[model samples]
Target chain A: MNPPILEIRHLDLQLGGFRLADFNLEVAGGECVALMGPSGCGKTTLLETICGLHRPAAGTIHLAGRDITHLPPGTRGIGLVPQDIALFPSLTVAEQLAFGPKLHRWPPGETRERVLSLAKALDLTSLLGRGLHGLSGGEARRVALGRALALRPRLLCLDEALSGLDETLHGEILAVIRDAIRREGVTALHVTHSSAEAAAIADRVVRMQARVPDAGERDLTANPPNGRWRHRSSGPPPGPEVGRC
Target chain B: MPSSPPAPSHPWRTRPELPFLLFLAAVLLGYLGLLVALVAANILTVSPAQALEVLRNPDIIHSIRLTFFTCTATAALSVLIATPIGYLLSRFRFPGRMLIDTLLDIPILLPPLVIGLSLLILFNRITPSSCCLVLGGTLALATLVGWLAVLPRSAPPAPAILTTLGLVSLTLLATAWFTRHSTASLETLAGDRFGLPMTFQPLGIVLAQLPVAAAFAIRTLRTTFDQISPRYEAVALTLGCNRGQAFTRVVLPLAGRGVLAAGTLAWARALGEFGPVLVFAGATRGRTEVLATSVFLEINIGNLPGAAAISLMMILLAVAVLLLVRLFAGNPPPSGQ
Candidate 1:
């Protein structure tokens, strides 16, 4: 009962036709969770609402114990790894790492030291001078991760963060991320449709069924659940982010 | 890894009307050469030094300097002010945006002289600002500053200066209008009638040019935006950078060259603005006499050599500026496009 690091309760995001109805989630401090759902099952909308990018039509989202429902994304200390790995093309790898702290007006010396350390840790020390013109998929993802980590966010939301990564690099990235999380005690909510990724990275997984209109839908809660799922007293934990729409 | 041999060149796969590029270049060069030859035939032969002596006449130099000073000042002012307007036009949608966009092009399409007349009719003897009595006084320098043309006969240089400066401003405005490259009959658009002192006055030239420069800058900025990728912005925002910081750190760097090109084009358009300056600022011998107006004067009033010499100087100055622009315009951060 460490204050829930992230929480979404009875959320209803009305995006025209589809409604993300009855969505409830919570992640404990220093814990990781995975959200497994189909393509259009409101996974992204949920994450965006958590990140304060989208406003829920009828719901409350508590992040780090603050009611951040109406806050802009920048005010909330949630880091998002979008699906497309939206790295700034105009910046060099090093500049990308410096982007966040520079905006927050951190001391230049500390920012520089942090950038160098992160570059070395991420194996981007040599690529410091490299411009972000045409990066291989893996390199871009790492740069993107470094950019997110620069903010030192309380929660890391990865929206299909590993989708574009090559298989060979995927294991390594996951391992790097796992180690970083353990070292920093940062909470993560990873979103993906891939079971292999869930099995590899998630401590626990929540199953999400597509929220179709309940005109004649069956009550899923009445039946014994088919797949293996561990339920929290409140609900499931937050997961990875979706690409910014 | 050894590089694979180059893939066989596509025979028909890559055809994209590219052959027309060289044809376009050739046609442009040939036309330019023909124009140069025509100018050469029209002028009396004179050495560069003799031409310099003729130019050394205080009267001629004064006229030339007035043209240079006014046009340069007007153009510079127009460009600096127009950038934000241009950026807004391309990026944002608001009420009256379309009307303002259309209104900006009027001075450019109409002859500079007509604009000057309209501006004059609006301002002095009628416009409230003109009722202030400052414009009508002899010390107002109406010929030089140009809002009041009621004293058109007091100075030999007032009308001509008004026409030249007016035309320069109008053309600057026109260049801005055309830069958008919209197929909307850009010229046929009329503006709100404030009956301001801009028309029929040298100020009209400045006024005329201001909107045109804005239009061109808008077009330039639009093209710049088209080449940018939002991925960079996405990255910065996710990294805790706000919109302003992200724009400065990410968008501007990659768009630097394009931005530079826009500014340079705007400046060049300002410098060479002629038709509007001719009609609005007028072809006065010493008042609003820009290079183009001087050329016009020499051709019409027996100073062919002076006109040719001034034209040549203008060409050299323009080439120098064009060269400077090219040199610096190639270094912006790589576009994700």
Candidate 2:
């Protein structure tokens, strides 16, 4: 198995007064981990924190064996496709896909080639010239996926990536995501509430709670001793401590 | 997109929208009738030759040019300032942000005369004596110095020397003009105690126009930026764009229609500004006169036909500007409040 490409320890965050304490997780390279939690459990907060959109109150985030707790999002080599599927309204599908490469100063020829290849892979060839607002929900979501993967990031963060799709569309997107992950072999941390979605795509699942349980309430803990994924079906452990697995 | 529910069985209750629509239409028609009557009365009262003569008057021609130039410059400066202010208000949260947002509305809400009075008081307190000369000399020196500083060090010395000579001559001419025109006004406002000539000067008109017009520009643009999802910017960032790159490449292009709308609205408002301009910059016949002021000037002189002629020009300017903006910047969808 590949080494862990993403490592989180003792993460503490308070978003709009909702506190997430001692949050810890890790994702091995090429592994797809689904983060499942109830609404308002800070699933998206963790994802945003990892990508540097929101600063953690405390804790360090290491990615690809490098400490990146204070790095800016653009330099972090991480891609995030938010739940809203926010395609730049002014850009065409092709331009949107080319955005990352262009920002990184990729040569014109190579950017074009990569855009065309991604468009084909995501079945967006005919829609490459279309404006973002004209795309359907499924189409826009797919374009967002293509955009996130355009940079070939070391870690991809998806926040409720398939939340709005119908069952068939969801399955289709799931298949496409699986194919892309298999092809790129990049680590992924996906946030969703759907257990079926987690089962469909994740190599392992991580659950977070709105409030870390008190020490006295501690029961079964999924956190193993070494900071690796451990499944627990019973009542939540008092809480997982930082680096205590 | 959903259609409204059917009204009640009673005819009056069933068609409530009809009365509302009719009431609004009547109010609109009332204003429309007033405009039509004004134009018709003016045209009938004056001969075509008399109107043409008024337009050809040196004072009238000069006023027209001054009006367009000052208003355009004010609108341009307001837009430049409003863009960043609007962006910051839309994108960031900070201590005092709410206070700043509320304060921005003060210019629009306050009477134009109040704003003008406040500016006069401010200048009086800060630089009452020799304000004109100090301001004029400082501006001239700064411009020339800035130009010289930007010249390439490795360029041929001959061109630089020639340009320096030209700049000096231009500065001297400007200084002479500022000294002659600004002195009398300063004496008038500050009375011999402190000759700070803001009243009855072109600069005074611009100063009066800036705040009121900038309020409209900022309001239009802030609403536009607020309506746009910040997610687009975040996505751009994830795509490897720095903050500046994201703003220029993604945010700016999307907000182009809004910027145009804001500029057009500010320009129109500046063109119509009279109260502030009158209070801050006295309606000096050939100097501080704009189309709006010319109307009042002609009216005060009992020249009804001349006033009508100036009012017609204002309407025409407004229509032309609105048309150009509509043609160039296609209308952005209105935000639901």
Candidate 3:
């Protein structure tokens, strides 16, 4: 049997005062997992660590049976739609969609085809020529999703990518994302605060509990093991657990 | 009948903070009035015809040309050097990072005469061969530090180690050759090799203007990068762009206005540079003289009118350039139809 598309074991990370400890997760090929937790529970930090923006304090991340714990983000074959919908302000909708393929050096014809198809899929064909400055919230979110999916990454991570949308737009975007994930045949790890959204899209929902650090863990927070800044937890660390929806 | 209600006090009179607010306004306007008065005095000191006559002088024309050339070169060089340094400072935190940042600000904070004196002393004390040796030694030290820093990281350490070793060896060999063969001051070498000596030369003017101007540019660029959300670059990285590609493709385009602002500010700073150029390049007519030194030289010759005329010209030129930059920055081209 093929190994899981992405596997994390004993993952530990600390950013500022927040920490994630002993976190473990697995997503099979073409599976979508929604990570639900309260605010400041290190959900976004987990996504960042997986995407190579931040290095893990300990543990390993495997993609397609290969250890990618130390690899750079570009070579990790992961795509991210950040919480802010970080669409490149300088790029038009078409350019945004084409960015990843161009960087990966796809031939012009194939790139154009992929862009056209993705624009059609995302309903961005009419807005392709438009810049990000004037894009509505929903439009910008679509652009961000399309840009991420354009590269056909092995793993796609979304950090609250569909939040703050009206019900109709939210449902529309959720459907678009689900279709794209199925058609593209990529695994996904989505961080969200809404259970409804998670249930509507995810194959399984994994709820995270805020883990209060014990006295022994308090020492680690005061003086971290590595050169990382001491994690001064205002409340508690998010200890993620695996559960079937 | 009930007594008529007392007339309401005027709002301005009833406000308790009115006097203090008026005082603040007075102070602000007084400062502005002083600047306006100074400019008016300079302008009224020279008749329009006299100012035009000053512009027609060959010496004055030479100074103007020299000023434009040197400041443009300085600003360009500043931007070139500042971009990478600024980016590194903005994006990374390494050991001694704070020290390096503070060191970068010395050029800006030091007295201009002190900077000039330091440069003069350095050029005089160091020969070309010795300079090469010092530079090579610095590179070797940097390579050692880089090797140590990267060794523990997950990155393939061998490639970085090998490349830096190769560069260090090459530099050491060059340094050895230079030490064995040549023993000439850098200024003399420059004069012979490029026909432009460092001391009392137009090139010296650029060197004098460079340090402070580059400091300003670095500050501007660093702030600009800080203001931009790093998530843009992070997103680019996830989309298959390596660090350099991410920076060039995402961060740079977003920093367009800030870059322009940096260059313009540096250019303006270089244009008004006086003490360093005067001390290092010397105010020689038809040679190293720039607008700032032209004003000085006119005053030295007891020509206050000519000095005021030149100062006025400088002010106008600086204003025009600033306005032009504002216009360009304010109306960025439509990103798309």
TM-score of every model versus the real structure: 0.64, 0.75, 0.86
Query: What is candidate 3's lDDT per residue for A1-245, written digit by digit as tens?
Result: 34578888888775545667777887778888888765656778788889998888798999998899989998898999988787888789999999999988999999999999999988999999998877888888888989999988899999889878888989888888888888888889989988777877787777665654565554333433322221222223233323322
TM-score of chain B taken alone, candidate 3: 0.84
Q: Which residue pairs clash within candidate 3? A: none
The lDDT of each candidate is: 0.64, 0.77, 0.82
Better of 1 and 2 by TM-score: 2
Question: DockQ rank, highest first?
Answer: 3, 2, 1
Which candidate ranks first by TM-score, i.e. highest?
3
Two-way lDDT contest, 2 vs 3, winner: 3
| Residue-level lDDT for B169 in candidate 3 | 58
Chain B TM-score by candidate, in order shown: 0.59, 0.69, 0.84
- By DockQ thresholds, what CAPRI class is model 3? acceptable
Tens-digit per-residue lDDT, B277-317, candidate 3: 99899999999999999999999999999999999988898
- Model 1 chain A is weakest, by summed lDDT over 10 consecutive residues, at A224-233
> Model 1, A50-130: lDDT tens per residue?
776556767788878888787767778888777777677656899888978887889999999989988877778989999
The reply for model 3, stretches above 4 Å from the true place, is A1-3, A14-19, A166-168, A216-245, B1-14, B132-181, B324-337
DockQ of each: 0.25, 0.32, 0.49
Instruction: By lDDT, rank the candidates, best first.
Output: 3, 2, 1
Tell the DockQ for candidate 1: 0.25
Candidate 2, superposed: residue stretches over 4 Å from native: A212-245, B1-53, B121-125, B128-199, B319-337
**Backbone clashes (count) for model 1:** 43
